[model samples]
Target: MLRVGKKTAEDTQTPNNEIESSVTEWSEKVTSLLWLINADHILPQSYVPEGLENLPNSNVQVVEEAGRAFVRMTQNMDEPLYVANGYISATAQQNLYESKRQQYLEEGYTEERASMVIVDEYFPGGADEHQLGLTFDVCTDAALNLDVDFGLTPQGQWLEEHAWEYGFIFRGAEGAPKIYKPWQLRYVGETHAAIMEKLHLSLDEYLAYLEDKGTSYFSDVGAMHLDLIVYFTDSLSEIPLKIREVSGDNNGHYIVVCYR
Candidate 1:
């Protein structure tokens, strides 16, 4: 885990100035579509998405771009897909998490054990991607109630294979810190999604890979002739002019997408 401790005067001074300078230099870059929101990195309780919209056939809301892509992706699927959850408010998340935790406690688990068990499937309040309005829990049948068995279903398999093509990714799975939630998808935009799928990297791994590579790391997605340039810097002055789109890893770096 990346531990950020409290900064002393000297530690804060230089880094603060550098960040200010970087922010000023990259003021035109805009907030990224690929922002990473997870348990370790959280959204504020007041953080409502700017483009929330109702998904076409569901009452659940998602950011506009992701909603559009989701609609298209679902339409192309051979089987029906159901939107089970999206855009949960911090309060609602808190309530649900607390309720579940209490249920676990009533079942005789200790407080710590209850929290651990609950978090294995649900994030507490602000520590979830659902608050970002760019995530959705989908299932082949709404009645299945989001069990691990969904991962074995045809709809889940289809999404695992094709969700990235529409800028979504299976956000959590086994072998990771979080529970395996095959039904949840987070939209990180098509360029990054495609690269992540091709390289077989999780979002966390992909972000770390970008940071290690530093600036000047670029790749081409062969068939589309798409150029991906990754920049990890305190400033964005070095970003290329032909940039088609920009996404932040939300961990102090930018990914620029361009076409050849």
Candidate 2:
């Protein structure tokens, strides 16, 4: 337990009597997750450091999940006192982050900072998800993942606003899956991206689709997607978008009316 606050076990028990009562008053289930920033030329100092560090902002993250606030330790593997090791992304994500930051700086946001993975960064065991390069810890940057419509920032709004534009999807958002971290983003490839864009399903709905439905579900989905595209596109009527249906129902390439 990160001990974001105090845990009580019925004032009757002595402090030593309730030494193992773990509870968070701020943890809440959300529909968000984070993308770990990575870079090639620059190796980020592993926030995962010496055994059991309890530093916020730089050391560990105080994420508010499941309505109760809990601390997610950002420490090394050998002495991991966390249920999950923050994800360390590949060099590609790092590059993307830096590039985006530079762009934002050019505009106004100077809060972007590159982070993740240190040389010999250790994790206790159990082949943590971060070890596989499949997970990433979200930073507090208000500007992230500009290329993806489903950006990881409040300024960008929820994935429902822009996820399909990029070749990514939210793990859960529609009528499926338990609402988890809303910041979590998953790369589902261009085809799925196009279809998702066309269908307008949030990350959650898409995952639900994969688990319960079949690829054959795409045909019907395609039509629904077409309608959404038309609706939003029309809303942007002032700015003409090159709405190109590069392919048919089978081809998952949707020529979006790119404003830029």
Candidate 3:
């Protein structure tokens, strides 16, 4: 498990001038958009995203904001992008795990090796990002399947350069641990996406970094004119400004970002 930090808002420092705004200005829905989900931070089986919208020409569904951003991304690109995977439920994930595990066993692999392979390739049930409607795997018509080779293609290259603008991050990019599928992208909104990309941090590392610091600030990122004040806290009452975004670290704290 990742180490959880215990920094409270009172322990952190903000700039001399704080933004005078109300925390209720931003919707509570922003909280779930950037949630850190993985094996160590498993998603609950009962969890399901609100207002999921179906992407065009795909069986997959994603949150409305993510779906809209994806549409914008596709429209801006010269070639078409397709959703290869999105929003897998716990039951569906179990089926996929069993299928792959059985295939490995059929290939004369031992039970332990088969299980290990499954864990590396596919997370079981509630432990996967696929269970979250905010994550998606993309591919082009020529490359319907996800693989490292797709990263060499025009679609992948374009996404690498511009996905953050649409609030998506390449989840399996460099510095990411375990399975590294270049096609996997997770929605964390534009501001945080820009910050994560700038720091070259995977979601896991980024969360841990912020937790250690207790607080951070950024200016003029992603066409956002106002300065951003970000901090980690387990208690909501400790935040000093209007919370623009709040994401659970999944390790006992909320990563709060506010604008001034």
The top-ranked prediction according to TM-score is: 3
Report the candidate with higher lDDT, 2 versus 3.
3
Q: Per-residue lDDT tens digits of candidate 2, residues 1-260?
A: 55555657644354532322211111121112212121221223343311233234443322223101122222211222222223343343345445655565666554532112211122222212232232323433434322223234442253335434434455433211232344444444344566667666654354444434422223323323432221111122232332332211111211222211
TM-score of each: 0.81, 0.27, 0.85
What residue runs in model 1 are displaced by over 4 Å at the alpha carbon? 1-29, 174-178, 216-219, 258-260
TM-score of predicted structure 3 = 0.85
Superposition error at 235 for model 3 (Å): 1.4
Across 24-136, the per-residue lDDT of candidate 1 in tens digits comes to: 54557555566777677777888888889998867899889899999999899889888888899988998998999999999999999997788776777788778888888
Candidate 3, residues 138-185, lDDT tens digits: the string is 887645677777789898999999999889998875222566788888
For model 1 the TM-score comes to: 0.81
Candidate 2 residues lying further than 4 Å off, grouped into runs, are 1-134, 142-153, 158-160, 172-179, 197-260
Ranking by lDDT: 3, 1, 2
* Candidate 1, pairs of clashing residues: none
* lDDT of model 3, residue 161: 94
As a whole number from 0 to 100, the lDDT of residue 106 in candidate 3 is 96
Worst window of 10 by summed lDDT in candidate 2:
22-31
